[model samples]
Target: MNCPCCSGKSYEECCKPFHTKTKFPQTAEELMRSRFSAFAIPNGEYLMDTTFPAKRKLHNKKDLQEWGEMNDWTKLEIIKTSGKNLVEFKAHYNDENGTTQIHHEISLFEKLNNRWYYVSGKFLD
Candidate 1:
């Protein structure tokens, strides 16, 4: 299947490795894409595992699953990737109420122990 991150690559080639721990994303945007794939695939465990430790507390599996279910993610657009740590993106999806909307945000990332962590995202209007 095609990658949900809209990378124009197969799931196995693009995001599955990240999801399954075979390989980790090398950049903030790559991480963001894998996370987007996680949401679209509803892989709550992967989402939880990838989130920064401090932020993971706010993202329980149940809640992530519920949110993923509520938002049927369709496409992902990387608006901009700045430096090696910040990525801005728009995720197009249909909400639980079936309203199509765009989730626009600028996300912060940091590297610790040579691995990238998702710090936070600032929602955009």
Candidate 2:
């Protein structure tokens, strides 16, 4: 499938490592790309696994599956990324109803076990 990040690359080439292995993203843009892949592929396990414990929402597999089934993510664009190990961006996608939505957030990340995990996000209007 075409990359949700609009990088003109396949999802496997773009974000599979962040979902499967010990590959850690060196930049916030990379992390955002992987997160977009997680949404597109319905890899809820990977999403929850990569999320920081403090920010984790208690979701059952069914719930995650339902979420995955409900939305079709179209694109992800990095607005900006900064800080020592933190970055934020605006992600865009369409819902099941085909209404486009934009998730603008300043996301936090923490490096652990030589990997980067999503910590938290503050939504912006």
TM-scores for every predicted model? 0.96, 0.82
What RMSD does model 2 have? 2.2
Cand. 1 Cα-lDDT? 0.92
lDDT for residue 91 in candidate 2, whole number 0-100: 71
- Per-residue lDDT for 1-125 in model 1, tens only? 99999999999899999999999989998999999999999898888888898888777888887788779899999999999999999999999889999999999998888778888999999
lDDT by residue for model 2 (1-125), tens: 67667788876777776778658677656776787777778787877777766667654556665676688876677777787555667777778889999888888888777667787778999
Return the top candidate by lDDT.
1
Worst 10 residues of 1 by lDDT: 57-66
lDDT at 3, model 2: 67
As for candidate 1, its clashing pairs are none
